[model samples]
Target: MKAIQISQFGSNDVLTYTELVKPQLNPGEVLVKNRAAGVNPIDWKTCSGGGAAPFIGDLPFIPGWEFAGTIEAVADDVEEFKQGDEVFGFIRFPERAGCFAEYIAAPADQISLRPDGLSAEAAAGLGLAGLTAWQALFDKGNLQASQQVVILAGAGGVGHLAVQLAKWMGARVVATASTENHEFLKELGADLVVDYKNESILDHVNNVDLVIDGVGGEVGIDALNCVKPGGTLVTLPSVTKDEVIAAGKAMKVKVEPIRAEPNCDQLDRLAGLYADRKLVLQIADTIPLEDIGKAFDASRTGKVKGKLILTL
Candidate 1:
């Protein structure tokens, strides 16, 4: 099987496309022939000796956390999935799950079946960002219907999804993006769009019930003022979480930093939403598996509006 592996942490130069032995399945795992893999900031960051680099164990590691594929084989204990089942998952996040390869040994309990209508590219991109948005809004923020919510970096991979999810949950959605993406966000169900480049986000709206802070640090600190008293702010960037949290504490606002976890049940529900056409996963670009450097460079810019996928 061909895979993107890093023998040492450095830059894009370290990501190598080479042939390797297939992975062995565990007791409750399924072997999947991957069709697509999602490229995220964490993928590049880890390869550059940051992000989840420390948690990924030793060198010569595979660095992908989300994928969509078909089951080639299954462990005897895995009764939920069979050979030839189309599946997708966000698994072993902030660690190594090896989704970049053509084959993956994924835990059966951590994956969900891909619904009939969801494309493999869409399913591949849906895992990490989708789960991040879902968990940040519903799980951590406890956002209620009819309440207002503000999402920072609204045109981003997670932000765009958060806008739609918040709207679907019956919340009044306010998103922050560049002027060019304002209309795009509105189409995604954001009721209001604030231009972060030319205008202040605080100037447009305030006293929101929840704020999903995708852009952390000073930007996150500034957005803390937008949350209503007793409302929650869910911060997603781990590198700047402490600064945002301390700022939240000084302002008497509650801040929750989140790392998206694997929940097969929630992913299944998200898949149902896709199958029903209630949810949509935006794809920024799709690159071949051998062109990981291009995808990595694009994601590193932090300007890609939607998800970047690698086709196998």
Candidate 2:
């Protein structure tokens, strides 16, 4: 099998596309022949010695977490799925699953059957980002219907999905994005779009029940002001600073940082939404598996409007 692996952490040039032995399955695991792999910031960040890099042990590591593929075989303990089943999910996030290769041995409970109408590229894009948005809004933030919410980086992978999910839950959605993407976000069900480049997000919106902060740092810290006195502020990126938590406390608001995990139940709900045409995935670009280096470069630019995928 052909895979992109890194013997050492550095730039995108370090990702080498070469042949590697097909992975063998373990108990309660399924061997998937990957058809598409999502290229997330975590992928490039890990490769450059950031994000989840510390969890990646040894050299010659393969970086990728979200993928969609067909099941080639299953371990003895697995009973829910059989060979030739189409599935998609985030594989063992915060731990290495080596999804950049053609085959991945993922736990059966971490994945679900793909919606019939959903393409492999689209399914690949949904796992990590979709789970991140869903967990941030519903589980951590406790967002409710008819409430107002603000989503930062509305055009991003997680942010875009957050906008749609919030709308589906009947929340009045307000989002921050560049002027160029304002219309795009509105189409995704955002009721109001704040132009982060030209206008202050705090000035345009206030007294929101929840704020999903996808762009952590000073921006995420500033979003604390957008929430109401008792509202919650959920930060998605693990890179959130300590000051954000302190600031939220001072403001009498709940501040939480979230890391998306593998959840087959949540993935099933997202897949149902896709089947009903209530959710849509935006694909910024799809590159061949051999050109993963260029995909990393594009992800590093931080300007992609949607998810990038690697087709096998």
Candidate 3:
């Protein structure tokens, strides 16, 4: 099997396209021949010895969290899927799932079947971002119909999806992006789009029921002023979560930090939504697995409108 491996964590320079033995399945596991893998900010951060690094115990690690592929083999205890089944998953997050390779040994409990209408590219990019948006809006924020919600970094991987989902839930959506992305976000169902660069979100919108903070730090802290009393602000960046929470406390608003988890049920629901055109996953670019470094560089910019994918 060919994979991108890091003998030690540091930078994109540490990633090497190399050959290794294929992974063997454990109980209730399936071997997937990977078709595509999503490149997220966490992947680059983990490789740079920051995000999710502590959970990755040793050297010679493979870094990727989500994948779409076809089943090549299955363990005896796994009866839910068979060979040649198209599947996708966001699995074993904050731990090594080895998704940046041509093959992955995936637990059956963490994956879902990819519907015929969802392409491998869209299915691969949907898992982590989709689950993050779903969990943030419904689980953590408890958003309801007719409520108002604000999504920071609205054109981002998770933000873009969150905008649509919040709208689908019947919430009035307000999103923030640069001037260039305003129309794009409006098309995604945002009733309003604020140019965060030259304008103030606090000025245009207020009394929000939920704030999906994708860009943390000062931006997140400032948005606290917009949430109505008793409303929630779900902060996505772990690095700045504590400070944001402190700010939320000062303003008497609720703040929650989120780490997207694997739920096969949620994955299945998202797949169904994609098949129905109620949900869509955007791919900024797709690079070959051998060019993993290029994908990492693009993700590092933090300016990508959508997800980056690595084709296997």
Model 1: how far residue 154 lies from native, Å: 0.9
Per-residue alpha-carbon lDDT of candidate 3 for residues 1-312, written as tens digits (9 for 90 to 100)? 899999887887899899988887888899999999988898899889888888888878889999999999999999999999999999883234489988999989999999999999888899999999999999999999999999999999999999999999999999999988888888889999999989999999888999999999999999999999889999999889999999998889999999999999999899988889998887889999999989888888878998898998
Per residue, candidate 1 scores C-alpha lDDT tens digits across 66-112 of 99999999999999999999999998932344999999999888899
What would the per-residue lDDT of candidate 2 be over residues 126-228, giving only the tens digit for each residue? 9999999999999998989999999999999999999999999999999999889999999999999998888888898889899998888889888888888
Ranking by TM-score: 3, 1, 2
How high is each candidate's TM-score?
Answer: 0.98, 0.97, 0.98
TM-score of 1: 0.98
TM-score of 3: 0.98
What shift in Å separates residue 250 of candidate 1 from its native position after superposition? 1.4
Residue 257 CA error for candidate 2 (Å)? 0.5
Where's the lowest-lDDT run of ten residues in candidate 3? 89-98
What ranges in model 1 sit over 4 Å off?
93-97
Count of backbone collisions within predicted model 1: 0
- Predicted structure 1: lDDT: 0.91
